[model samples]
Target: MKYSETINSLIRKGLNEVNHSINGHLPLSIRREILQTINEPCVIGKISISCALKVYPIWNDFFKNDTEIIGLIKQSEKFLLGQINEKELLGNAEHLEVFVQDYNKEDNIMVMFAGMTDVHAAYDVLTSGGMEECVSDEEALQNPDTWDTAFIASLAYNGGAVALDAINHDRNKEFWNWYLTDCIRIAFFNDKLPYPPTTSIVSAKYFSGNNIKEYRTQPNIWKENAECRSRMNDIKGILVKIMDITHWTKSDFYFYHVGTASYTQVFYYKGNELVKFNLDINISMYLSRKVEN
Candidate 1:
């Protein structure tokens, strides 16, 4: 299942509740409440997918290829949620940066998860622990930064990356393009950013050996070293950490886990030791989380 479906299904449920409460037509207040309930998740999902697609047009294209994801555009009703189409979302994000710059134009920007999966999942997780209620709309709106919106987006983005990796491995050039593009999108959206996005290599972990050397010169060193092993393990650790942190959204996260890379591996040689090492362990990440402002 795609992120869009998770959102659409949730909205339908909420709307159904509103519909059942009233006879023919809902009153303005009831309508407003219903719209509010539906809008946040829809907008969150749209912005997340749109922002992600901006970085990874291939991902957007993948969704375009996936009939279920593209189906959102076919809905007759219009809302902030449905407005995001795969193409427009993937369209020149760098170009769109100008508009955002003109709007809030502040370096001290924060991202909030508005999509259905993150918001609802986070709320459920939190509330299940015994909070008086799930995070209030007022609270989410008041401080989007504190909300787990990007955390949810992180799950979706990373989930897609894992799937694409498995389907074609590194051979899927299109998926790599999509992966890198989505990486850029997460960086931009989460960082509250504009671009031509600036990037500095945080770190590079490589995998290399006879098998890998045939692929590249100077050999990618992901495979055979204690250090590489350590780093790769670190990557795994981080992924699990994020997973544990977002356990509340586990079910939602699982939905997008399809078609993304969950872990990665590479071959490396250290001294006499020859081993297959994993680089970043085949997981997708929000670069912003790993970077410092």
Candidate 2:
């Protein structure tokens, strides 16, 4: 598809924005607009699914016969389409959470990156949230679900880029810089959400008893949509804010886990002291911010 001059300009701007920054986001006004339009929790879940599919090849091959991840992805999409209730979806998410916790992928960077994408997809249960934030350039909204969702989306979309960075750790090349320019990911333009790809992963052999297409959760989207929109708009009107602390620990091995503050940690000796570091969605951050105002 041909990009309009405006979109081409925006893409170029996005490229430059990520060129030197550790983390960046669309402007606050634009982000707010996106949050406004996405009142349906399923919409946010769709965002997560599309991002997760970005590294589908890596995920598909790395796990071989273990189709639990694909099953989870399929379940998630089905849930968004009203094929499953929240209780059932939560059960599936818990099962995937346990699977991710048991799998060990930290030994290989490629597996680790792709594995993280799966982990993030499971977390995209889409009981979504967006906080009403204070007026400050330092913030990109601090709601727990939204902040964590942002991180989840990043890992899903950038798993390949991160794997490339690992491969070229010694060569000092930035694959992320080129990854964005090489292809125009359709998800960035149009969305086929709530529909996981009808790939080989969903063959009857893989889908089997897990299929729930015939039993929609039967939500009344027409009535719920109005309520959700009003509620989300109220969240936007909030002035609550958040603050968090970055922390580190010491360990001699690698560890990875999913759900809640899911994290990946690798230890390296800093002059004889092995240290591990990670970011967390500390509730204290939000509590402190809310208390302060």
Candidate 3:
């Protein structure tokens, strides 16, 4: 595609903004995000404005990253040019954006996680308001061995107590909460959400008759079926935020099954409509358990 003076200006502005944001120690993934956002409008087509109008969540969430700013400019370029193709101009939409791959060519992706802890003491003592049980005793015993960062973050914190402990450990609970805020994601640009009708199974049977014809029947299993859902989402113009933490253990070998607090959101143009989507998911992280050897 031909570049206009305006496009060039936008690109320059984007590069500068991104460079500063990275503080000159930019990683390749971030750099790609900046490039994709700045060039999206020029390459795709008004996706930016449309998304701003319909997907405020995405706009609000990703505004923290340089990619969002560049994406707006790129969308402006596409809108002005009127060069959208059939696939590009679907749904009478505005923005058509794509995600940035890493310098290593690894696609940008985020994972979910869950975490836990173990104690020689009873669960009550560990959770109760007894310093001797949960704090001092464990500390004096040098039993940092049982604290599972991911596990404690997921399950124990469900009741707010673990949250308290988390705050005490880092003393930066406020920062961590803000860090893991929810955001929506878009799968692709110029894509439309496909809505399908629900289905029902009127009758299901397991071969349980005693006759030779029905001989040796096994129980038939059934599961709740869900229709597939799809929509257009652009990853290029959005910022994905993820949280990372490494827990400490006292024993050389302690085991933990935990989840990490990380996620992603995207902005998209489906024809003329804009959309935002999010996923609050979980995954497991494992560490060897500490045992008296």
TM-score of each: 0.20, 0.44, 0.15
TM-score of 3: 0.15
Instruction: Kindly give the stretch of ten consecutive residues in candidate 2 with the minimal lDDT sum.
Output: 239-248
Tens digits of lDDT, candidate 3, 233-285: 11111122221121211111111122322222333344454444333332112
Task: Count clashing pairs, candidate 3.
Answer: 47
lDDT of 2: 0.43
Candidate with top TM-score is: 2
**Candidate 3 segments whose C-alpha is farther than 4 A from its true place:** 23-42, 45-293
What's model 1's overall lDDT? 0.30
197: Cα error in model 1, Å: 18
- Residue 56 error, candidate 2, Å: 2.8
Candidate that beats the other on TM-score, 2 or 3, i.e. the better one: 2
